[model samples]
Target chain A: SQTIHQWPATLVQPVGSPLSLECTVEGTSNPNLYWYRQAAGRGLQLLFYSVGIGQISSEVPQNLSASRPQDRQFILSSKKLLLSDSGFYLCAWSVPWQPQHFGDGTRLSIL
Target chain B: GIQVEQSPPDLILQEGANSTLRCNFSDSVNNLQWFHQNPWGQLINLFYIPSGTKQNGRLSATTVATERYSLLYISSSQTTDSGVYFCAPLVSGSRLTFGEGTQLTVNP
Candidate 1:
């Protein structure tokens, strides 16, 4: 019965603006959280992952960063967004080395 | 780091047809998963086959860990099955790396 929730189902941001996307999970504690971005017609790209609060691992260097402020809350943020930062952002949670459960993604459009 | 690849990048099948999607991975994986991303951009986990075969209704999945590959079989496809199928692998951690999905279209 675990569920993941993401906010601002759709977002439109002007270039050079700040960005913040939140993800929260219920029915589970101490689960792993991840942030992935998918560009149009492209594969899902791993941006960041956290195993616990205040612990995050970046897969690729980019304009975005992720933070696990709470056990079940993860936030993806950027001080200044770029045009290339536009994509569908997904939040996922999983047990240690297990299959992941994803939230309905947020479609971000940076114009 | 592990690399995952899915074959037949695009497939078109008529309703009631059967299709098999293949996933090949480099390096040993402790977890292999199949996901269906609907047109609405919701990702639904289809299978979590690490080293065996499992069947769920009209869908079945088989993973040969030793061979480093997995297969997802969809029987009697429906228009609802038209979407992107993604294969991802997890190795000793919760983070998963995904393969470029296979776009399947089931024409009604």
Candidate 2:
């Protein structure tokens, strides 16, 4: 069975602080990874996606960035966080053109 | 980019009641998926129906690709089923565009 794991299930960060969220998948290799953010009462917004290591595509321009350091490890980072950056961040993995499986998600609160 | 929309942004039902959720896409898609976001915020995959119908226990889904829409039917809802239902479409590429989701609350 494939499973996705995310670190720091919940975080509270000060404004302008650096941030990093990690995601890794077990039981799968070379799967596509994605980063999505959901604001309170809003739809999930695609922030970034990676098809392979060192390859990332940004869907919406914002302060956040994503990186794929290993075949199954993806990290979402920001040099300086903004109040608007607060949201529930989700990490998902899928085979090319297939349905995605999501992690439990990280609830980030930027103050 | 394909547009995905889910109807009845909010729904309330009594336990054991039957309910239907609808999802309409703006364009043709190669993939369509239904997910249940539990109260704890974990997304559980319910169906991967791009076309045709699939049933799983008390839940069933039908995707009319030709009409660019899909339907999810929940028979005999339970209190545990209270949560958000999301529908997303995989367009030309493998990226998925999610809908706003329909919030369903089943009362006991």
Candidate 3:
């Protein structure tokens, strides 16, 4: 079975501080990776997606950027965090023509 | 981009009760999935019903692709089932668009 791992399950950072959330997939190679955010009372919003190593597509323009340095690793980062950056972040991986499997998610709070 | 809409934004039921949740999509999709987000904010994929009907234990799902709508049925509801149910449909690519979700609260 394949599993997705997201680090720093919860985070609290001061505004203007840097942020880095990591996600990796085990037991799957060359899987498509995605980053999504769920704000209070809102639906899941796609932030970024990667098809392969060093390839990324941004869905929403914001202070966030995603990178896929390796085949199974996807990272979300910000040079400086904003108060509105607080939300539940989810990482997911999927094979072609299949349902996505998600990580446990990271609850980030910006102070 | 496809638009996904979920009905009964909120649902309240008693234990052992039965309920149905609906999802409608504005355009044709290549895949449709159902997910359950527990109170603790953990999302578990429940079904990947693209066309036919499939069941798992007390939960079942049916998708009529031609009509661009899907239905999820939950029987003998339990407190553990209280949470938000989301419907996500993929449109012609790897990305999936999600509906706001159906918040279900089951009472004992």
TM-score against native, each model: 0.98, 0.98, 0.98
Candidate 2: stretches off by over 4 Å: none
Model 3 local distance difference test score: 0.95
CA error at residue B7 for candidate 1, angstroms: 1.1
Off by over 4 Å in 1: none
The full ranking of all candidates by lDDT, starting with the best, is 3, 2, 1
DockQ of each: 0.84, 0.79, 0.77
lDDT of 1 by residue, B1-108 (tens): 788889899999999999999999998988888999999999999999888999999999999999999999999999999999999887767767889999999998
Write candidate 2's Cα lDDT for A1-111 as tens digits: 999999989999999999999999999889999999999995898899999999999999999899998999999999999999999999999997568999999999999
Interface RMSD of each: 1.1, 1.2, 0.9
Worst 10 residues of 3 chain B by lDDT: B89-98
Q: What docking class should model 3 receive?
A: medium
For model 2, give the RMSD to the true fold.
0.8
Which pairs clash in the backbone of model 2?
A: none
Q: What is the per-residue lDDT of model 1 for residues A1-111, given as tens digits with 9 covering 90 to 100?
A: 898999989999999999999999999999999999999994998899998999999999999999998999999999999999999999999887568999999999999
TM-score of each candidate's B chain against the true B chain: 0.98, 0.97, 0.98
Query: What lDDT score is found at residue B50 in candidate 2?
Result: 86
How many pairs of residues collide in each model? Answer: 0, 0, 0
Reference-based lDDT, residue B59, model 2: 98
lDDT of 3 by residue, A13-64 (tens): 9999999999999998899999999999759999999999999999999999
